[model samples]
Target: DQQVKQNSPSLSVQEGRISILNCDYTNSMFDYFLWYKKYPAEGPTFLISISSIKDKNEDGRFTVFLNKSAKHLSLHIVPSQPGDSAVYFCAASVHAGGTSYGKLTFGQGTILTVHP
Candidate 1:
């Protein structure tokens, strides 16, 4: 079974609008949640992240919400622009701490299309 999943394959939003992408995971040990955005022919770039200790984290037009109890997380982008169109991937990892690099489990990417 997949540890993380994105039920919505794609979402479309008008320019200067709001876009919401949802993700779910089954691993309770995951302590860190992150979102990465990728465009065609490029590697994913880190967008934002939130720790399990916190319920939410925001940066500029991007916000990430984590519901630990529900094992779910969502990314919200406000005033979405056409340039924001890309594939968003939700990832979680159990930060083992102490210089140990734990594996990151990623959900299937959600494609977001921002039409101008």
Candidate 2:
């Protein structure tokens, strides 16, 4: 069964507007959340991430929030721009011995379109 899911297939936002992308996970074992953004031909690049211990993490214009009780997480982009348009994938993993490698599970990506 797919543990991580992005219910919305796509989201459209206007430039300078706030864009929120959401995700949900069914696995309670997951303790780390990661968000990746992929361009047309390139690979998905890591955007922002949050540990289950934290409710929110921010990096410049990108922010990621995790709600452990709800098993939900979201990525927010302020002032969405054309360059911010991409496929966003949410991935989760269980932290083991301070390492989370080889246990990552990804959700189906959501397409984000920012119109100028």
Candidate 3:
């Protein structure tokens, strides 16, 4: 079974608008949640992350919210611009013994299209 899932395959938003991406997970052991943005033929770039201890985390125009009880998380981008158009992915990892080795379980990904 897939531990992580992105229910929406794609989303479209006008420029200077808000974009929300949702993700869900089944593993309760996951403590670290992260969001990543990827472009065509490029590696995913880390966006924001929230630990299980935090309900929300924000970085510039991006914000990530996590609900541990519900095993769900969402990423929100305010004033979405054309440059924000890309595939957004949610990842979860368990830092076992502080030697995670950078292993992460990623969602299928949601494509966000920003219209000018």
16-56: candidate 1 lDDT, tens digit per residue: 98999999999888899999999999999999999999999
**What TM-score would every model get versus the actual structure?**
0.95, 0.94, 0.95
Clashing residue pairs, candidate 1?
none
Residue 85 error, candidate 3, Å: 0.3
Give per-model CA RMSD.
Answer: 1.7, 1.9, 1.5
lDDT of each: 0.94, 0.94, 0.94
Task: Write candidate 2's Cα lDDT for 1-115 as tens digits.
Answer: 9999999999999999999999999999898899999999999999988999999999999999898899999999997999999999999998875565558899999999999
For candidate 2, the 10 contiguous residues with the lowest summed lDDT are 95-104
Q: Tell me how far the alpha carbon of residue 66 in candidate 3 is from the true structure, in angstroms, after superposition.
A: 0.5
RMSD of 2: 1.9
Please state the error at residue 4 of candidate 1 in Å: 0.7
